[model samples]
Target: MAFNTSGFNPVIHSSTGGGSTCISGNVIVSINTPGTKLLYEAPQDQVAVTESFVELFQINSTFGADAAAGGSSVISGEYSIFVKLCFPNDPSGLDKIKTVQLLTHGATLDYTYWDISPNYSYIDVASAADYATLSYDQLGVGNSDHPDPIQTVQATSQVAVVHELVALLRNGKLGGYHFDNVVGVGHSAGSMLTQAITHSTRGTSTP
Candidate 1:
């Protein structure tokens, strides 16, 4: 994976306690892979929704392997992902904190899901605990760029985006902070994406 970033926020002071600070930026990620085209159609009603799932399950069970065996032209695109990094004011030392949490939200949500408010924000909670947090709006959501949903915004591509983010954090490219340990935290569909990252990048550098 290769990426470029722009629109970096120098510093955004948190109004919440614990003297936490935040910085946000947009990253443009590009990857090359066979494009995924789903044949399923959008359901119109509750019953149709169930029927659509059943139909998709049956189709996958029948032709999934054959489809996987087929080859196609690579689909590639650059997606701008909006991300925020929050940490406690390091009065003691930055070296004391070497771990960062990578937060990913489920479908129909964005980065703000982790930061609903000062009192309820997970970023604030982590900062108060002396830990840093990184949250991002996945492609096609929030402030990020939107490409063809079925082709460029597939699960593999989503994993690729998060993977590059981990690289940036480990290499201190974002906020000039290098974290030896990066953790993955996700909700619902985001959890599946994180699991995919762990599985696909096994025996390789990943969160």
Candidate 2:
């Protein structure tokens, strides 16, 4: 209930799919994850961005996974991520549930992609089914903090952010709701992040 609401939209209703009320806001997340070097130099323009991608692909194709192999240091940062938490408008038992779906959007898209409209809104569908939903703008995308693109926002750091978010949801730090269960849902690149989180054994020993 005491979530940071700076520059956040107040409560809103989704009527197209069903009557679902959502609190659109932002949360500050801090995380530490293994870091890797940028495969290609940072681009200066749109064309350069494309060229950088091409170069990265060529290097990967030529060297396979070895091209990206390297020792990793711990990368840490505090970032603000835009998030929306929604629940069914009707007074069903769903409001008391602690389970939630954590949604992450693909590259080039924001949290809005999940709730494009009432008719096509994923949040509305979940709400009607008596499930709570939480969607966020991944770091370096949309309203979230944008750090050094090539260095700080790599795949490992993105996965770390998602893991941190899952911890927050489970520990009752986010939205003051303690969710014992978290289901991660992602699109495209986001799906890769979720997969990494699912299969990761990074924090096992905590050495």
Candidate 3:
């Protein structure tokens, strides 16, 4: 809820897409200090479905501006940016598939996961079922790789994997493992998967 005012600045940029050309030049401005949770409001002009913006955050090295000789670089601080699209008066114009694509593509290039320091890690839910199978195989007593059997449900597709993630995030055996430090990021359809898991986690009581 509190803002990180010590080191903070915000920049905004805009562009036109779809079949239209860029009308107004992209805008960029810096904020002296801002809240941790920042929102980028879309512009009123360039009201066509094609115009959009992107937000980016730059994280400075924590160690130092420059890496010490024969040593690793450090992170100094972090920078964040957000961009939005301006659409015509049409209530549903913002939700159009083409407009969404333009916005997504622009934002993707502006902000990349790899740019963030201390690379973030996530549970590989894509192959959760495979991991479960391997876990079961390792538990069998007959095989050298086997020891004891553990119960697991099969997750054949991304949807199933998402369901499993939601269960774990909510009331599954590992539910207690949830913590504030965790961050979730997904792309394209993966975003929907994360949303489903997130929705399932809400309003659930801890055992």
The deviation in Å at residue 55 for candidate 2 is 3.4
Ranking by lDDT: 1, 2, 3
- Per-candidate RMSD vs. true structure? 5.2, 4.2, 23.9
The lDDT per prediction is: 0.76, 0.74, 0.23
RMSD of 2: 4.2
- The residue-level lDDT of candidate 1 at 10 comes to 54
Compose the digit string of candidate 1's lDDT tens values, residues 1-207: 111223465545562343567777776666665555654344669999786567558944654544344444466777778888877766465568899999999998998888776577888788778888999999889899888765567777788888888988888888777899999999888898889888887887669
- Between prediction 1 and prediction 2, the one with superior lDDT is 1
Per-residue lDDT of 5-124 in model 2, one digit per residue for the tens? 333555454534555776676777888887876454556799987765675578336533543565465679898887787777775464487779999888888888877765898888
Poorest 10 consecutive residues of model 2 by lDDT? 1-10
lDDT of 3 by residue, 65-134 (tens): 2212233222112112222222222233322312111111111232222122222311112111111100
Worst 10 residues of 3 by lDDT: 130-139
User: Which prediction has more favorable TM-score, 1 or 3?
Assistant: 1
Q: lDDT for model 3, on a 0 to 1 scale?
A: 0.23
* TM values, all candidates: 0.78, 0.81, 0.19
Clashing residue pairs, backbone N/CA/C < 3 A, model 1? none
Error of 2 at 41 (Å): 2.4
